[model samples]
Target chain A: MMAVTGQFMILYVIAHVLGNYTIFAGAINAYAEGLRHWPYTIILWSSRTLLLISVFLHTWYGIILKLENRKAKPETYALTRYRSASLAGRTMVWSGLLIALFLIFHLLHFTFQVIEPGIAATAHPDALGRPDVLTMVVGSFQRAGIAALYVVGVLGLGLHLYHGIESSIQTEGLNNDRTLPVVVRTGMAISVVLFLMYAAIPVSILMGILK
Target chain B: MNLTLYVWRQEDRNDKGRLVQYEARDISRDVSFLEMLDIVNEGLVKKGDDPISFDSDCREGICGMCGQVVNGVAHGPRKKTTVCQLHMRHFKDGDTLYIEPFRARAFPVIKDLIVDRTAMEKIIESGGYISVHTGGVPDGNAVLIAKRDADAAMDAAECIGCGACIAACPNGSAMLFTAAKVSHLAMLPQGRIEAGSRVCVMTEEMLKQGFGNCSNHYECEAVCPKGIKVRFIAKLYREFIKAKGNL
Candidate 1:
């Protein structure tokens, strides 16, 4: 699942980067404006639907692993009076879940606004009456605090991915001399690349490079 | 520091068991948990009292021979370590330690701090082996199992048949023990021929021994000294489902 999600996140980033390149065509804002007219764009609809499914599956398996871990070490982590273990391993669930929460908020802030540009909080019925993905992305990253939060979330994803890939192979009984090393290294590389790429996207936008 | 022991003593399999308190003097902090018990037994022996009988051998951690309900834990205080590996220092000086044999309908207490772990032996005997003939050794290269397959098998083979999984489990299930052994064999081509009967017979033997069903709680994985995971049981379920034609 570490590999699966790491690969998925990388895929999402690549799609984001490639999709962002659409602005290079002509009048990027016009493309954003044209995007609002289509009731159900093919790339928009299918990709969004697949993204939702993958997120669900990722969570579904992540929860299974967590529950299993809890069952095995009921008192080890939770009930131990000594609270000096590494905070990284201790709050693994919350850290991973924070990443999930960030992804949802990200989709809402960037993608939700594009669907129904006019929908207001209570004034609009659809509740998704918003547009301006660029502004939302720029505005969200422009905030120093929000940028820090995103940075932490990406780091959480990295830490979570680090342990998750190795654990998943061991759990799935897919460990081997040849493939285990390959899988671990690839998972590590993908995790690092995705974190850097995602970090750069926000930092670049904040620096007005996406201008 | 010496301690007071409240041990659960049962005369025989048919007899009722109850808590019997005895004071142990001058316990060494460096001694293993069982070594402390040995000191208590020596104290009883000096008075011509019946020494508390517990299961143990190869006092080193590997044999998985020593197990007890020490202070309500299946093993003692340390996580992932076995009873024999636990030392006296973890407890406070002069603390009253409660020692009890692991109890369940599946594991009937035979004496103080000792139960009939033969339930495990029986499960292994039922279907834990491959049907190979004893003769000239076959070349290892003859069987070209993938490196991955061999590694997985080795991991599953690490199960030491310690009943800690049963003791730690809320349901007293031995599914983990049986599954680990089964998985070790089932992963190889030599074992695949008997996989159908092996799972059926061993699972039946586990049930017959009055061991509880695995509900996937995974306490087995946590307390397992060998770290034999709960995933092996999931693998068992998958294989059984496949063999039963349910999948």
Candidate 2:
């Protein structure tokens, strides 16, 4: 259940990052306007619903698995040593919790526009009578603290995906001995590319390159 | 070589275990790890003290009868080596060793360095077999299996059921052992008839045994004495999902 939901969320994140590229193309305001309008609005709302469900299930099962795994090992060794487990593999629960926390803050800051009402896009319309999403996003990223917080959140997502993608592949039995190494490398490559793509937005805006 | 050993000592299942220090003085480096313990046991016997109890049958690596965590690594620091086959030469002179029994909820400590592994037997009994008629002996050439499939089956069949993988896993999952059993059979034509039910039944039994789910840490593969790969686990999932789809 966790793997399925996690992979679904990863798909959503990929689409989200691709959509976010509209800002660089200078069509972010029009794109946001199109999403809020009819027809496209249906896709927007339905995708949001699916993503919300995926997040809830992913976090719920992650916690249950963590608790069950802990219970399975009641007595720990006096000197524990990991042979092949990676640092990211060991701290999955921590990274997952970080992502969950960031999601909440993200929704409040951007989607709901309740966190910073002064820069809320809903209150400021562009010249085309659309929500000034581009300005609002650029304005927010211009702040050093918010940009740093976004960097942290993106890092958490990267670390989570680094382990999560290959884990899901293994869980779903999509890999064999010959393909396992390739799958692992592919997963890492995807994670690094996604991280660079997502983090580049805030970083570019902060450097006054996207404005 | 002389070494200090901090061995876990427990009277019974109810007793809270504690690490008791023992000096293994002037021990020969050529002896197996179990033999070194035997020398310590002999000294305790002479002094009228309760000797440490551990499980071992063949003392050979294939029996899977002996398993203990040496310095926190299951089956010791050597790769793909069981405790019984582990030699004293691996450790340097004057080194301190911490030896503990396999620690998992399913394999509780019955005494010092001996955990009850009946849980694993229960898993095997559930569905780790194939049905064969008791009539005339069948010819070996009756089954003409692909060379690739036969080798893969042999790879998975190498698992010794030592419980070392469970001991090493942070989740204490039995997926590696169960997967090995399932994969070895699923690769054979005879075992394919009951593959669907076998995977489901064994998975159910594993969960019922209080074993945790696999988190893909690959620690089980790392500590496995048989060099069983995690690919067998992936095969187990493949067989399981295919079975579920059919159902």
Candidate 3:
């Protein structure tokens, strides 16, 4: 169930990244406003519902697995050494928690518009009379600290997604010796591409490249 | 090979254990690791000191009896080698070794370096067998298996039921061992009749034994004496998902 929900979230992230690139085309505000229309609104809200359920299920299963793992080893070794386990694999819980916190912060900043003043109240309309989401994103990332925070968040997301995707494929039994290298490469590709794209938004804003 | 050994000593399961240093002087370099311990045990016996107790039947690596975490690596520093098969020649003279039993909640210390590995047996007993009639042996060609599956099953079957997978796993997961047992049976046509129930029961028993879940760290595969691949674990998950639908 955890893997299944994780795959769902991966799909959502891919869709989110593709849609979010509209910012570069100067269509982000129009895209954002268009999502609120009738048919698009239905699709948007349904996906939101699915994502919400996936997050909840993923978290719930993660906690259960963590507790079970803890109970399995009541006593730890006095002196320990890792052979094949990566640092990212070992720090999964920490990365997962960081990602969760970032998600909450992201929703507050964008969906609830609670982080910045006048974000929710003021109507910054574009030439097409659409709510100007591009300006809000640009203004948020223009702040050095916010840009740094976004960079850290993207790094965490990349690490989490890398391990999460590989693990999910393993859990789903989609890998064998012949295909494991491909699976690993695919995971690395997805995480790296997503991280670069997501990090570019804030980086371009902070560098004064995207107005 | 004058080796310094830091051996774990515990009277019983309830007793607290600590590492006791022992000096084995003037040992032959060609002797196996277990033989060196035997020499040390002889000296202790002559002095009326209690000899350390450990589990080992076959001095060969195939039996899966002898194992110890030498220098924090399960089955010693040599890759894919059991403790009994490890020779003192691998170590330099005056080298210090930290010897401890396989540590896990499912594997408790019975005495000195000996741990109770009955948990593994219980998992096997749960569903590691095929239900066949009590009669004459079936013909050799009765069931013709595909070469790929036969080889895959053979790879998984190479697991020697040793608890090294548990000791090596940071999470203490026995997924490799359990998966090997399940996959070995699941791949064969003779065992596929009860594959669903076998996987379900065996996995349940594994969890009940307090073993952790696999996180795909591949630690178990790294320290496995038989070089069992983690791919069996993936097959186990596939079998598990299919089994759950049946259940």
Predicted structure with the largest TM-score when compared to the true one: 2
Q: After aligning candidate 3 to the native by TM-score, how far in Å is the CA of A136 from where it should be?
A: 1.0
Pairs with steric clashes in candidate 1:
A113-A130, A116-A130, A117-A130, A119-A129
Please, what are the lDDT tens digits per residue for candidate 2 over residues B1-247?
9999999999999999999999998899999999999999999999999999999989889999999999999999999899889999999999999999999999989999999999999999999998955347668877789999999999999999999999999999999999999999999987988999999999999999999889999999888988999999999999999999999
Cα deviation of A49, candidate 1, in Å: 2.1
Could you tell me the TM-score of candidate 3?
Answer: 0.95
Look at candidate 3 and tell me the lDDT of residue A36.
Answer: 90
DockQ of predictions, in order shown: 0.03, 0.85, 0.73
Per-residue lDDT of model 1, residues A56-120, tens digit only? 77778767755654443222211122211233444557767988887776556555554234432
Q: DockQ ranking from best to worst?
A: 2, 3, 1
Interface RMSD of each: 8.8, 0.7, 1.0
- DockQ for the candidate 1 complex? 0.03
Off by over 4 Å in 3: A119-122
**TM-score versus the correct structure, for each prediction:** 0.57, 0.96, 0.95
Candidate 2 residue B92 C-alpha distance from true site, Å: 1.3
Q: Model 3 over residues B1-247: C-alpha lDDT tens digits? A: 7989899999999999999999999999899899999999999999999998988998899999988888888898888899999998999999998888999889999998899999999999999998865357668877688999999999989999888999988778999999999999899887888899999999999999989999888989889999998888999999988988877
